[model samples]
Target chain A: MLNWIWIGLILAALLAAGVQDLGLVQLPGADAAVAEKGSRMAAVTEAAFDSAKTAVNIVIGLIGIMAMWLGLMRLADKAGLVQLLARALKPVLRRLFPDVPDGHPALGAMVMNIAANMLGLGNAATPLGLKAMEELDKLNPRKGTATNAMCTFLAINTAGFTLIPATVLGILAAAGSKTPHAIISTTLIASGVATITAIVTAKILERLPAFRLPPHDPPTADEPGAGKEATR
Target chain B: MRELLQAVATAVSSWAVPAMIGTILVAALVRRLPVYEEFVEGAKEGFQVGLRIIPFLVAMLVAMGMFRASGAIDVLKTIASPLLGAVGFPPDLLPMAIMRPLSGSGAQGLLAEIVKTFGPDSLLGRQAATMVGCSETTFYVLAVYFGSVAITRTRHAVVVGLTAELAGFITAIWVCRMVFA
Candidate 1:
């Protein structure tokens, strides 16, 4: 999965750079392409350095926002607000995630994450999402393998349901659009569809033979005679 | 109607953070909880989470950045134009949609470029903006969320995430056409 995609990106990048350098592929800027055939791979190496710096900077930027939200969330949890919210959403969330027990902290984190996302609050959403993941991980039967709940949660995050795409609107407004908000309903509709698609796909895929959990539960297996051993 | 919705959206976006924080702090105060101490403890953990994400972010972004700089997307654009044309989608907007799942900044840059090249009021610009609005940066989300938890075996998460992204892109194009075209 991630391993293949990571390696593929690196491999394809090197291959593309090589092809461009060899003049096998015509670049958009013909003059510059001809002048810098040898520099294609060098550009990739440069990008690696630049992106590493950018990555650190991105995290540094997140620290303030993450701290604020996590602090607020901590206060919410302490006030029992998180549990109240989780309980309110239990009926719906239970259907989406049957594995997570009622009133679980993960449910609260997820509810907050989705709420933040709906408000187009990226700064709040990521920390809350990661918090949700941490809570969900606590319930993992296997240490490294992703549980169905995790997959569903990730699916929802990737779908990114939103009421207003503030950043995109801001970009359009900055570009001098008189009607930058014209796409609001359209974005809402599209993201709604995408979110539904992601949940359904995750549910369907999780039930498939390839992705199903093994018949043997590890924790049970660890304790000899704790359960009836099935013959393989 | 649109203007009213926009106003409300703007107001919500502006006030959401303050309102949420205020409510939480107030609620904690009323409950007699040590809000300041709890916040500091949570903030400390937040700092740790940010630090932990550094390696994963570097790994994911470097690979994506190299791929972006390699001119691979241009090649993909050239290869994908015919298919896009068949569906009546603007080929020029392909780069933004493709980059949407990979990098947030890259997609933002592309959206800005498109808005600059094509008037923001134009159909292409509107479509690009909608696409950006709808689609999440799937790879970044996957890396950070899973990475924070140290979960390496992400079984169907990638597949599902990409499916969601593709669905968002297509729906963005279709909905844009229906509403703005």
Candidate 2:
């Protein structure tokens, strides 16, 4: 229900925004501002679209590179690189995620996810997330609301390591500031606090009956809420 | 060299400084508390998780770098001006807006451009940068975080994020109008 409501709101917003943009809706106060900054804005808008297209193309290259990287990493794992990392990660992962059992496949998944985030690799982080979820599901055996550990893992990922504040600062630098690096303080402050907050929030929320997975009666494979993500 | 030094210093002070302080404090406190064990275990898993996505991060960063150097971003900001101004954002911020869903650096590059065009201390530049700072890292969060967890129920996280960006933009403009204008 909540998810549906959110989807509706998003679609409505996008539609309304589109209509307003096309002049189908006579939105209030649109004209004056546009008139005032018209020429400068027009220039910027043109630049942004072209830049956006170029940005997408460059992203395409990165995606290709990342796919190759993943393949290489997999080969390394077959050669026991993954096992070595997994063994090394065991005690530490056990310490950080006590709820997750040692030797859990998700161990590798979680580590990979975090690694990706630290490097500011959104594209690379995705496969690890999916793999981790698969591992978590196997552990679950009885599908229901995800376990406390799963919930906690998600929270940490959301609040990620945020390693390269440089990228952000670098962008600031290019944007024409005398102090482009000023955001170093801000990203650190925000990302750190947000991660902490997410951990706490997920912990508290998980305890609530609503967030908890329902009882695993008979522990059947096909349960009511198992594959119901697209809905509510 | 000085600018590079300053950039490095600022980066360390801003991001690393906070991480070090916060992580130590949190680690200590959590270690002390019994329940915090679960969180620590979760946190320790974080490093490994980070390593996995390093490839993605590197690739994305390289892409972001290319975008910045390409001179393409300038054209985008101009095209988005009219539509964005309807919402009270300056056209100089158009790329920032687009990048909100795609990449942070993409937006940051645009933010840098705004600062260059209007001057960083200028009303337009400061507000835009501040808005970027205040706003969330959207696409990165969604694709990486949510995707990893298989969270079909984003629970309006995306909406909340973009809304926060829009609100910050408005607030920055309002505050700038009062202080600088």
Candidate 3:
């Protein structure tokens, strides 16, 4: 899926640049006037290079925040705080992922990931989410294919029900918004709706014939009855 | 109603981070966890995770930069504005909406630009900020998370993710217009 999007972006970029170079379309605004100095293609290439550099810088910037959150998370985990939190959310998690057995490590990991995400800890969320996915993969009957649980998990994560939206606030503050945090309630409401939609959509889609997992693939490990357990 | 909501938001924004940290520390203390050692271990893991994401970040960011700089987003904005305008979405926000699912940094840059051009107090700026807060970079998340697990076939994840992003976009516009207007 991303493969197609990546290719499409590159193709569309080249096509747009070609059109600009040919003077086939003159865009309105200062942006159009800037194209007079050089070819749009060259400019696009330069921007891509610049963004590549920026990407590295951004990652480096994330290290400190990521380390801080993950460190706190580790302390929480060792102290059984994660489990306590996970237990509190178990009923909801169980309903969302019936395929995952009760008390599964994946459930714990997923809970932690969601908690970290809600705090707007992007770096921490990714590792924890990856950890959750790895745990989910262990329960997959198919070696390469994604399971329903995995899809649902991804959907919810991508919905991004963040409470703080720290990055957006930081950007708005830097941009000199007198009320940088004014969007908090709106963000919560919007993302909350998106999260519900994502879960419901994933659930319904999995039931459709197109997305249903094939029956021939038998559960290879864990409980012999675990495969049947997932079917419910 | 709007004033009350804004006040609540202000309170949460101020206390959210500190509250989270406080909760974690209190939990650690109560549970008698080795706070300092555990932190070091997790921090190391976090550093490794940060390193792993670099390649994926570069790939996504470059694609985004190319898309934006090639004037493709402008073309999209021109084409999409009328259609989106009918639904009450500000045409100027089309680029950020389109880029939201593709790249986090790309969307953040667009959000900053919107705030700069419209002023952070402007309706468009507020809407863009809310949109940013609500949506995730679907493709980036998919790449890093799925890539980590070596999952090649994503199945319905992309569909569900994009659906969520669309929901966030529409809701952001609606909520912002109601609250900030």
Best by DockQ: 1
User: Compared with the true structure, what per-residue lDDT tens digits does model 1 show for residues B69-143?
Assistant: 888888888888999899887899888877999998899999999999999999899889988888799999998
Candidate 3, chain B, TM-score (2 decimals): 0.70
Better of 1 and 2 by DockQ: 1
Best by TM-score: 1
Candidate 2 yields a Cα-based lDDT of 0.52
lDDT of predicted model 1: 0.87
Error of 3 at A232 (Å): 24
Off by over 4 Å in 2: A18-66, A79-92, A121-123, A142-147, A217-232, B1-118, B121-140, B143-181
Residue A213 C-alpha lDDT in model 1: 56
Better of 1 and 3 by DockQ: 1
Off by over 4 Å in 1: A30-38, A217-232
- Candidate 2 per-residue lDDT, tens place, A1-232, comes to 2245334433433443344445555534345534653532343344445544654454455445444334433433334444555678887677556766766657776776777666556555655565566567566534433556666666666454455544555555655557655444444445555555655666566556656555444534454343543221
Better of 2 and 3 by DockQ: 3
* lDDT minimum window of 10 residues, candidate 1 chain A: A223-232
Which residue segments of model 3 deviate by more than 4 Å?
A30-37, A50-81, A173-178, A216-232, B1-58
Cα lDDT tens digits for candidate 1, A1-232: 8999999999988998889888788868634643564488888888899999999999999888888778878888889888988999989999999999999889999998999999988888999998899889888766578999999999999998988888898999999999887888889888988999999999999988887755555565433332453232
